[model samples]
Target: MDRTTPRPGLRAQLLRTKPVDQIVSEAGHGTGGPASMRRSLGLWQLTALSIGASLGTGIFVVLGESVPLAGPAVVVSFVLAGFTALLSALSYAEMAGAVPVAGSSYSYVYATVGEFAGWLCGWCLLLEYGVSVAAVAVGWGQYVADVVHAVSGLTLPAWTVQPPGSGGVVNLPAALVVVGAVLLLVRGAQESAAVNAAMVVVKLVVLALFCAVAFTAFRAGNLTPFAPLGAAGATAAASRLFFSYIGFDAASTAGEEARDPRRDLPRAIVLSLVVITAIYCLVALAAVGARRWTWFDGVEVALVDILREVTGQTWVGVVFSAGALVSIASVVLTVLYGQTRILFSMARDGLAPALFGRLDRRGVPVLNTVVVGGAVAVLAALVPLGALADATSIGSLAAFALVNVSVVVLRRTRPDLPRTFRVPLFPLTPLLGAAMCVLLALNLGTGTWIAFGAWTLVGVAVHLGYGRHRSRLAVPAPVPAREPR
Candidate 1:
């Protein structure tokens, strides 16, 4: 059987499957074809990848929006969201280690559940990462505006700061920040990771400064009645804050590049989750302790409210806003990185156009990075994503569920595979992880499911129209010849 040979029929083409060994081997080779995607990540860089992705948008942009829902108990919401993320992170860690591939869950599911499911997962991830990048870029635009106004008392033009629905032609700053990340990524993985690490440190230091500065004004009276809306409200807030946890699996996207995929990927995933969760909790506590929850409700930049409390100087506010800008920029970089690499893997496997998988001499997917950045920049400039955050969350949670189930299935089928990191409780961990992801997705409401359903329908159409027979894996591998008797 030859790889380029067409399958016999439509059904065969649509359902064509690749064995785990074949998929893993191709991924290990780094090219899967003529163009080779480079592997240049280590544990620290991988940690920066996840931290840079998930830590930006939530604390700076969404926390104020969530305060009305959970009151002072927003702190509890951060903890709960961390728990859900931990479950999914464990599953991703195990699979990334054992599979050691760039596609993340997309490659893992292809090996376990067949082609259609794999394509569906990859499609969902595309939605997740794309929206995440746009959403964070928009947030970055706002912070940048704040910093500029703080320094010079001159606001960025409204047309450049907001989308059309908000009475602006385009989010120019948002699109610009996305382009900045594009330039860094096009340089090379090592360059991108180095910048990401530096930004991660900046974000963390700013967050710590925020906590310390805010605690100086802490009165404790604000939390007297913490659960204003009750446990239900806290749970709802957790569902919303789960948006912040989207990028832990970003480390899994670097599985092929990780210096020790089996050891480093899992550690990076888990460590990033823990550090981000801790930061969220501390900041949430400090913010609530400093001001009543009602004060933060509908607030855009909640950290500024506390940063202004600096008795001696006003520079703290400027520093905090600048830190937020750096954080959001890093997030756009890391998530965009994940998006292109995953698509690269898909292209290599014949699911996407070969152009997307093409790598330049430096082993970077230059064209692919530019294309992804351009699409997301347009999305940030043209689309109002305020209402679509839930839609993005649903897509991410669905992909997480698929990954958790893939882990269990792969365990049964490929038990002999080398796994430096294994899910702790076997069936229990994955079962719970998959269930939690579905539970969170359901909490995203009916609108999200409708949007997801529509996107998935389009994906099915694309697969049938282009990816069906075009997939390189549709043809089976040839059998070895027996020795002459």
Candidate 2:
């Protein structure tokens, strides 16, 4: 009964009734209603979900920070980050196709690695999806406030616009947006998906417009000192650019809800990665080409600034700002959805409070939504954006690393397990995925690394304190059957 000690024959205990077949069958039982809610999402809707979740303040705001590091080579940084993301996506696709569950990488790790590793994955995901949602919400507030000021010829008080450490009293707008996203998620999954799809389209059209206009002013001179800062710069910029790719996991989280998940889950995860990477590269190319890389210093809204320069019209700025507002909202909604689902999985497994596992009549984890929403709202309203971004990036890289390893483990351990999709080149693909994630992690600052270590330590403590004792997998093992006489 000791919390840290697993039951005798722990693996057999956990594996008793939850083999992949049993899990899939249980998932199918309510496929009538839950699957219907999930089936409302299609390829386009899936693509939109990816676009909405992936395209946000990361590209809009982080681009300026990365430009300074890599100069015009920021485009290359984006490409490198995209490549890393693609590698991870392939791994996710293979695993998701094989195991199609709601916990995303957490579920895959549990089934392949062991219960303890699965618990860690669920914990790390808390930072990736939950904290990152707040970061996105905070970014949305900034753009929304900007648009309001431009259109109405008035600005909210400076204190309202800035977060606490940024010399402001409170970030009212950021907190409000987080609250709004939570309410939307608590209502129903179907409603959230529809709204997300619409917003995704709007955001993509806006980015396409920006690309078109910016190309008019594209200058060959901008390409002169690509990598002006050298390999270190490219690596550093890639680290920052990595943030833009964080939401690719959103596709995997929908595993429990996808129709024909064995097929569509992999398709959605890989397809989303391909589409988002292409869009990011195009946007980075246009933004860097349209103006001097140095000009981007101190600029927060680089895309809008590019549009303004190319079109020589103030209204284009207004239009771009509006698009940013909608895009950020979509990111918040999709990420919040992912966060709630992860907690629901953890709760169902008894690794957390059981309340999180309860689904309302609408098939939504309402309590989980409220808890996650409140935590993110407070964080968004209080923390510095830089700290939030770094924390999210580190957590995501860790999760990606585990997922890549899980794909390899599952392939070796359960070769007969049916997989609808497989990563090309076997071990090579997963190896590269882990390598890229490590390279990106190396780019994180010493402080960020320290913070990541601290977070992991905290997770260890929480597991021992609560999760170890309550884990459904830790129940006493059954006695082995005696041989027939």
Candidate 3:
């Protein structure tokens, strides 16, 4: 056996693992030729990115859908989902600090699990980030309609603002917002982070206003039958509500762009989750407490309507809708940014087309941004919000579960690696994280599972046809020696 030659066999090729040091080294060397991603994000900017990506959809849009499922117990549903996210977040923080690369869990899994698994995880992330961006964009469009109506007393044509089957020929506003975010992303990462940070602040303030006003109308009687549907309902709602926390890992995707990823990535992930969970709980409590849970059904802008009803003041709702407009757009921006970076990482590793790896002078992946943003916009224009949200939850749950497993695997496989942050309780924490991910995923609709399976099959075909042969780790056969004439 030649010591230098890669072992033969499909199994060996599939399980080929990249070394952790090599992963870190490639990132440091600027894998994108002359225009590598710049490290401009500090602790707060990274935290803001996570919060900005996370705070929008659940509170502004999905709360309406989730409340009906869980009734007033929806607050509990939020907590359950947040707890699940926190567990997985701990694992993400650990691996992110240890690896600190652009691909988030995709890179971590490659270093711990194998190339094929990493490719699949990255595929799941694509489903998560890309679809979530479209979902959030649709939510943004809802608020855009509301704002236009509030300002002009004229409802935009339903066909222009709503997805197909919901009366719209095309959701133009949703598509427009996705395009706007892409333009911002093309400028530079630092500029995008700064804009996102401002929007996050606005989001927090708007949520605070909602909580204060909604509490004024709170009645203890509204809590009479908290769990109108039962435990099963709450569990199901939590499965969908998991979409709310999808962007909590946004910071981890920016590992290569963080100024101090080893320390700041861990802190940003934990801090953002804690603050986001608290805000979500408070907002959910206020929402259901102020109004009967049944009233939430079919209300796309629940918070705006709640404010309008509670104060009998249309202006109040208008103000909140404006904030939501900015908030959801911020999410579309950050999640889109995360998706582009994930593709950039995969492309650099030869798992994706090289177009995704190219960057301009300012270190922005221009073509990658346009392609991803255009796809998300088309989805937003065509797909209904409910289906997009559910699909995103399933994909996110799978990616998170893999992250937890990667943490445990890496800890055992490379004890000598320096870990700036470690998941407490060792194997127990990560194991519980994986278990919780499965629990939530099982509660999702059968339709989502079917969609995920289809997506996985497509990913497998892409990998076998393209990535397997092109991967940097795929060894070439030794050329036949030529006999001397």
Candidate 4:
């Protein structure tokens, strides 16, 4: 096969041969077998998984940084970010219903746009999901340390608990969390989902308690300097909170496991967004109202601090810290699941090493999970939380832009396909989604852009050197036709 000839009508080959149903069944079951792992997830479990992935350290920890920038208007920023996410979710719901695959945006982009764009989207998502797991693990370690000190009156050495830039030797607790989640994933999806659901409940209960206590001490005067830095500040804060909205797409990634993906995927995506955004708004309101926004500077445990101030109760801080720990663990587990499945899709399509696509005796991608977990653990142990968060945001924003564009492209090219859910405004909604993602990307600082660009260059290099040569669609140049399930 010639490597530079654009794969001889590869787009048509993929479009005609790989239908939505075929892709969903392949991901849900196995390629060369009858029944693989049990399909235990229904719509409710699926929705909970999305919520578990979306509501995490981003909400509990990042608010401290955003509040100082937007004041009480951080509430407004939440709304703006939620609106942007809602738009993208609508587009995703449509495509997920239309395609029903494991790779989420990558699969959607491939079926709609082309092979190269799909590879790029998948590569960007690797950074988004893998880096996020590491960042959340770091946050989990801080919360766990705080909980231990509050209950036992004994503290671990700072050198062992903090990341390098934070003046620590290594982040032991963070690395442990990543390792633990990796082990859980190797067991199978059903077991992992059960654990994730329990963690989600714990996190929600803690946040609800914190909100109740903080609202009691709410002071109207704290909101006086709302939008202190004006629209620019609001935009910047929205960009930051945008990170909080990253996991809503997890609902779409589980298309294969969804009971009725064409119908359920869209519902789960929108429902998760609504539920998470509502919780975030209330949390933001309580945090700002509990104390002056100016006092949030240098604060890591924003909710715990608010609870401590509101009730003058040290126990409340301990409880909130416990919740934060559980929340971060759940985030790591679910994001790692999304990442491994994406690599599985890439491997199956011959875009990556076959090892990543192989399922173990438990019908789980054990090797891919271990590889991703080990990489993230190294990052968590060595990198600063701030740097990790910035890189995650950049990659997530790029992926979001690609997904939004993919939605528009698919609608134009495949109008006759049965769509379980559709974006109401057609081109308008998708265009807005793309524009919002670009605006958020612009709000990121120069350092973040440089990091993002460097990572993208690496992805480009991998594609040119290896992916282009191994892609199945490019190898034999199969004729385009929708494959039967």
Worst 10 residues of 3 by lDDT: 1-10
Output the number of the TM-score-best candidate: 3
- In the range 300-417, model 4's lDDT, one tens digit per residue, is 8878877887778899898788778888899999988889888888888778998887776666778888998899999888787777787888888888888889888877777898
* Error of model 3, residue 382, in angstroms: 0.9
Q: Say which candidate scores most in lDDT.
A: 3
In angstroms, the error of model 2 at 257 is 1.8
Best of the two (1, 3) by TM-score: 3
Model 1 agreement with the true structure over 272-375: per-residue lDDT tens digits: 99999999999999999989999986678889757885444668888889999998899999999999989988988888998888878767888889999999
TM-score of each: 0.94, 0.93, 0.97, 0.93
By lDDT, the better pick of 2 and 4 is 4
lDDT of 2 by residue, 182-252 (tens): 98888776688889988888888888988889888889899778878998998888987788888987867
Sorted by TM-score, highest first, which candidate order results?
A: 3, 1, 4, 2
Look at candidate 2 and tell me the lDDT of residue 397.
89
